[model samples]
Target: MAGSDSLFGFGKGPPALLLFLAGMLISNIGRSAYFVCVTWIALTWSNSARLVTILLFTSTLAQFLTSGVSGYFADMVDRRRLSVSLDVVRALVVALTGCAIAAKIGIWVLFLSVALYSVVDRGYLTAMQSMIPALSRRRSAIAANSASYLVMQAGTFLGALLAGYLLHTLPYGIGLFPIAIIFATSAVTLSAARTELSDPTHANSIYSKPRFQLRFMYHLGRHRLIAPTLIYSLGFGVGFLFSSLLAAYVLDEMKGGAVLFGQMESAWAFGAVLACLLLISGAGKLLADFGLAPLLFLSGTGLILLWMIPGPITAATLLVALGVIYNASRILMDARVQQTVGITEIGRTKGAINTAATGTGLLAFTFIAVAGDTLAPSDIFAQYGLLVIAVAAGFLLPALRGRPRSHDEDRSA
Candidate 1:
């Protein structure tokens, strides 16, 4: 797999990249599992859709405030070390929160834990994305992004499946501590891999001259990244429509419990894994041009379909389709950003994008939190779907990519 044209499509990918992606798998598994449990528990504790939305709103708010700074930090220091440290911190957060839950502490403890985890999660993710250019042996960043996200989607699928089983078999609080253990293991796994920067001078260039600019968001127009950034941000934002409300949709509308919720989540995750696998295999090249519109339209249609026909089977099937659409859009955006941004600026660029995405997510959470009492979860899902559909009708693909690089970019194709 370390050859010039490996299965990952990234020619000359280093062993460290393989190791890093392995670590990513472990970490995503933990993250997905932990959140699945947390959301279910939060709902069970409060028995209110409004409270669940508020809880998720707290996580998005935390990300909104710190994402830009986290981006800068990703470029300022050693990304590997920063990520390892953040993972340790996240492990502690999750562990303590688990203990708090076991002790029947107030909901504030859960909120505090999620908020802290949210901040660290942003930096951890940004650092991971920034590391791909350095780790992929100066080859196609799209290939590297696909490989990494492919691993991520697979891990989430497994984790959701695990969560589904655990939620049914295990005690509520017992599931949270295992996530801490998984994160801690990921930290150790990541620490074992070295950053194989082929061009150390340029790859490490961001440390010498750091970028802490907030106006980069406004100036994305100058570099011709704003269109893609805005479009992807919209795509990213609509995800909150799922994360914040899906559990409630399962419980209230589908009339299901934690096991059913987990099943739906796992189905969605498995579909995402398949999508990433398709992209990584270079079979999705034609899909690259179909752009975000198809993904958005598909998502909107799936959500609306779920609303129109509410059943456990329907939700699971529709979620699988929606998940594929969502991850395909994300893979496109990630590959686009990696192609456009140089290594030194990649961190800040991703940071800016994440901040904007989180802002939109925050708005979604707030809306659901405020209006949760009055609306069915499926109703909100349909509304959000329609909103994106309207946007989809007017939107085209962003000019995110320049001409393909003259190197190994399309080698697999």
Candidate 2:
């Protein structure tokens, strides 16, 4: 089955695609596991919601700063090697953090590690996104993206379950060792990929020229669809706030322990998996037919429904719906952006979108840090839902006024 050409929309199941997916799977598992462990540790150490928010803020800030530069390099550099190097660096960082935990070091070390890791991880992600078009046939871009999301969601689900189990039964430092090992393995797996970095169609020819220019922004801004869609991407940050607050909600509102928190995380991942499956199985056509506004509205409605009812079971159910809508919308938008932009600008365009999204997340984290002391998690969840709704409504008018553009129209713009 693994060798089947029809599998994952690849004609011959290229080794590069297989290696890339394997590396992504392993690295995602490690990243997801470490995220849970880190969040729990922060909560236990400080017992302050604000501290947890600050931890999240540090990572987002790093990503926000690194994304633009990373995008530029993704276009100009050898992406495959850059990705492998990033995985190796992240492994070393995680190993050092594990050593710090063993030595009973301060929590600040973990914060610093996460911030550093976020910067490298952003670059790796930008490279990965930019490489997708080069890796597969043009006709299979959506399928490739859907397959990637499936692997990512699977990693998240398995990783959350494993982390919960380890944190519950093993020592803290021991739990981190798995993360380090997984990242190291990811680096090795990625080394097996046979990537063509010199594809003239994808490679920027003038590699020596300065990439940080205002003209790049002007090019992106001139596209009527790309600009609004990039701004609309901020809604993803608002939607993701649930992940940041999940541990708190499980501990405080649900009166549950680490195991329950992990279960909820896995549940969210399962929802995301279902969403990816839908996209892979042809629901992506709905996105192409209807455009993004309808999907965003549906996702906002799901969030509002989540807010209207407050309970562990209710939240879990609604999260499944939100995950479906949210991930589908995000993947669709990302694929659209990838399809619309020129190969030379793909990385920078994606980077700009990521920067905007992460910036929005920084703002949300600031809000949570300040207001967490007084407001209930449920209240915050509701307000975020409202924000999603407001953003969706704000975009609906433009979507209705303007007809959906063909691929030609998008490219011409």
Clash pairs detected, candidate 2: none
Candidate 1 lDDT score at position 198? 24
Candidate 1 accuracy as TM-score: 0.90
- In terms of lDDT, the poorest run of 10 residues in model 1 is 404-413
User: Candidate 1: where are CA atoms >4 Å away?
Assistant: 1-7, 11-14, 137-139, 195-212, 396-413
Write one digit per residue (lDDT tens) for candidate 2, span 1-413.
24555566544455666787888899889888988888888887887777888898899999988887888888777788888899999988888888888788899987998899899889888887777776655566667678888898899888999889978987887779889899999988987764543233345355324555323454356444454454356557645577578788788878888998898888888888998898889877765566555566676676666667867898888777777776776677667666667778777777777777887888889899889658767777777767766765665665467966444233221
Q: What tens-digit string does per-residue lDDT give for candidate 1 at 7-41?
A: 46554345665668888999999889877888888
RMSD of 2: 3.3
| lDDT score of residue 318 within candidate 1 | 82
